[model samples]
Target: MPTLPLYRDDFYLSTAEAYVSAVHDDGAIELDQTCFYAASGGQPGDTGFLERADGSRIMLGETRHGADKSIILHHPLELFHSDMLKNPTADQSAPVVGEKLVLHVDWPRRYRLMRMHTACHLLSVVCPFPITGAAVGEEESRVDFDMSETIDKDAVTAELMRLVNENHPISVTWITDAELAANPGIVKSKNVRPPMGLGRVSLVCIGENSAVDSQPCGGTHVSETQEVGAIHIAKIEKKGKENRRFRIRFGVPE
Candidate 1:
């Protein structure tokens, strides 16, 4: 069985854990715990590597969830574990049933993703329309919303600029999947939920308006809006029939 990801509890920094499971056939390894964030919650997968006791190392290419939901599929860049199976005998002290390991994630990439993800939330307060869909990424981000013809894109742009000026704080917390299940009303508004059977859920809050905008989420986010100071409405694109998409991005003004 694959290990549960502990890094979701603390996404701002990288973490280390012990060796837990390995797959011989596919040349992959699953640490007892990992700092490598999986690709879920609209936030992209984290990129990094693993180092063994003997100085041998492998690249972590992909971190994704399996069908069973409890197991995580890890794809390594090299055949770091191929030798263990091919050899008739196991090393006297080689990692077998249990061993110690460390998980390291690229901090710069993670920091940027957190900033972008939180900015997307702040955007929600400024953009009057209810969001239909959204995505948070390292380079750019987008949010689509249900629109009325009276909505003015230009006015919304000004509103966003004002929020950036206000610099409201951002925060996060966790709730049992059951707590969310009990309150179906909040879950329906966001249109996203934690993986089924997962024990708990992480929630991201916008400013102090927790009662109004607290949402069930598992993505990384900034400590406060100050970090996401001033975002520009890069573009406003029309999609489908009545839906409109807003493209948002962060940059130093010229």
Candidate 2:
């Protein structure tokens, strides 16, 4: 069954009720619906625990997509050793195929990620260069730009904080794949195109009427720029002849 991703509609949704649709041999559990954000687009998958009706907890190490993007698998932490999900032991017990479960997302960690992801977007706005790569993390995030211009990290940090203090409202607007194809300029990533073939794409816009920035992204973000809070461009490193990597951290520069 295709799992309905509840987070796509509500990033703040941390808990939801779902039923196990399939239990993989590797001990990954698939649900009919989930609030857990599956690992994708540089954002790590959600880690939390599932509660059975009797209140026993099944600790999830990660939520990720199966070979089919629609099939989301929640892996038990016990299956993971050194961040890799190992094959299940022969004696390990698994969730019943049709059992009910209540999902819970680790909110403090997820909120940090959400804030960091939004900060990455703000970094793109400040740099205004084509993004080559990026990753959102709990303590920091890095955005690689396809540019050779000499920029000041402290100056950039000031601009980032300016936007953060402005508290620009962030919102998601859906557009058809055809519309996205028609307006490629809205995409800021030089190497990654938004996930397509799903018929529609989500454009995460900042500011009123997208006055600040707008780009297609599948990752989670906070509701407003101020929520991003105290971010700084900690370092700028030259990756190659033209690639510049900016490291963003959640605190004022010392």
Candidate 1 accuracy as lDDT: 0.67
Residues 1-254 of candidate 2 have per-residue lDDT tens digits of: 88888998899999999999998888889999999999888889999988877655788897899987778899998522222235334333567989998889999999999999999999999999999999888988999999999999999999999999999999999999999999999899988777677678899999999999999988899999999989898899999999999999998888
Looking at candidate 2, what is the lDDT of residue 25? 86
Per-candidate clashes, comma-separated? 0, 0
In terms of TM-score, how similar is model 1 to the real structure? 0.81
List the candidate 2 regions with Cα displacement exceeding 4 Å: 79-92
In terms of TM-score, the best-performing candidate is 2
Candidate 1 regions with alpha-carbon error over 4 angstroms: 79-97, 150-154, 188-191, 209-212, 252-254
Cα lDDT tens digits for candidate 1, 1-254: 65767776766657576675765556556656677777776678777766666644566776766556566655676535436668635342333446566666777888888888877776676665667788887778898877645456567657766665666666777788888889766542245555546777777776676732576677788776677756677777888677778887776433
lDDT of 2: 0.89
